[model samples]
Target: MKHTISALVKNRPGVLAESSTAFHNNSINITSISCGETENMEVSRMVICAEGSDEDIAKVTKDLQAMDFVIKLDDLARKEFVDRELVLIKVDVNKDSMSQIMQIFEVFRADVVGMGQKTITVELSGDQERVEGLIKILHPFGIKSMCRTGMIALKRGDE
Candidate 1:
């Protein structure tokens, strides 16, 4: 199962390493992790997506909460939340394919962030499904490369 957990931890070196130890101890494989500055400069919100059993995930969350650096931990699976991922896809483009690729980008609401002699790099940020859909559609155009920022999430409503 997929477990989405968030931790507001001190913005300091080795914090990420320590927090990840909890998951490692539980034998959970983190599928994706995104960490960035929060409104408070002293802290950063780290969203981690891991694959593990419900029982293991529960234990991992407990272990994380016990850590000193962790100011807060939110188990997103327990509440309504929003999650998004950002991806940059570079696809082969030519006179014959440029127009079609542009149309595909328009349909997916993707932005063309870069253009090379034979490739165009497009950027999209959305839910996993939306991002996957765009990638599937763009495959026909011959993907040259891509980079994705894994899932980042926040719980809904006032905490």
Candidate 2:
């Protein structure tokens, strides 16, 4: 099963490394992770996605919550939340293919952020499904390079 764990930690150096090391030592496979400062500048929130059995997830959660820097922890996988990811992809292009690629980009609502002699770079942000859909559709165009920001999520409703 996949699990999303959110942790609030003090805004200090090495916190991210420590947290990741804990997960590594526990044998958790992190598929995605993102962190940024919270409303309180003194603290930061980390959203992490990992795959493991329920028992394994529970153990890691417990261990993470016990860390000195972790002020709070939430198992977002079990809650209703909104998640998103951002990706930038560069695809090979030519006069003949440029128009076709632009049409496809319009269909996906992706923006052409850069253009080079033989390639066009696109930037897209949305849920995992939407991003994956665009990538699948553009595969035939030949992807030169791509980069993705891992999933970031927040709970729904008033918390």
Candidate 3:
């Protein structure tokens, strides 16, 4: 199983490191991590993923919340949130296919971020399914390189 955990912790040195070390000690492998500040200097949102059964994740969550620097924690299951991923892809291109490639990008609302003699880099941000779909479409055109900012998610309703 995979769990998406949102942690609000004190924005101080060693807080993030200690929290991550706790997860590590529990044998949880972090699949993704992203964090940013909020209005409160002592609080920041941290998103993380790891493979663990719900029970195991809950235990980890409890441990995390008990940490001195942690302020709040939420486990977002499939029901309560929207998640998205961003990816940059560099695809092989030629003059003959340039227009066609542009059309494809237009259809997906992907931006052409950079270009070289043999490649064009596209930047795309969307739901996971949509991003994966775009990648599948671009594969036939020869993807030279790609980078992904793994899934970021937030609660859906007013909270």
Candidate 4:
């Protein structure tokens, strides 16, 4: 099963390394991870995605919560949450293909952030599925390069 775990920890050195080690020791494979400081600069929030059996994920979560730096842990996979990912793609473009590419971008609601002699760079921020779908559509245009951010999520409504 895929799990999205969020951890609130002290903003200090070694917190990320320690938490990652804990997940590693528990044999959890981290598919994605993103961290940033919260409004309180002393605390940071980490969002991690892993694929593993329920028991294994539970064990890893338990271990993380036991750490002194860890202030909270939430298994977001089991809750209603809002998540997004950012993707940047550079696609080959020409006079003949420019209109088509623009149409594709419009369909996906993406933005053309840069233009070069033979390529146009598009930026998109959305859920994983939408981002992946846009990539699929852009593939035929000859993708020169692409990069994606790790998924970041927060619980929906009042938690």
What are the Cα lDDT values of the candidates? 0.91, 0.91, 0.87, 0.93
TM-score of 3: 0.86
| Tens-digit lDDT string for candidate 4 (11-118) | 999999999999899888999899998989999999999989999998998888889999988898778999999999999999999999999999999999999999
- Name every residue pair that clashes in candidate 1: none
Consecutive 10-residue window with the lowest summed lDDT within model 4:
150-159
RMSD of 3: 2.0
Predicted candidate 1 versus true structure: per-residue lDDT over 1-159, tens digit per residue: 987888899999999888888789889999889999999999999999899999999898888888888998888888888889999999999999888899999999999999999999999999999999999998988999999998988777885
lDDT at residue 159 of model 1 (Cα atoms)? 56
TM-scores, all models, native as reference = 0.94, 0.94, 0.86, 0.93
Off by over 4 Å in 3: none
TM-score of 1: 0.94
Backbone clashes in each candidate structure, one number apiece? 0, 0, 0, 0
Give me the runs in candidate 1 sitting further than 4 Å from their true place: none
- Listed per candidate, the RMSD to the true structure in angstroms reads 1.3, 1.2, 2.0, 1.3
lDDT of candidate model 2 versus the reference: 0.91
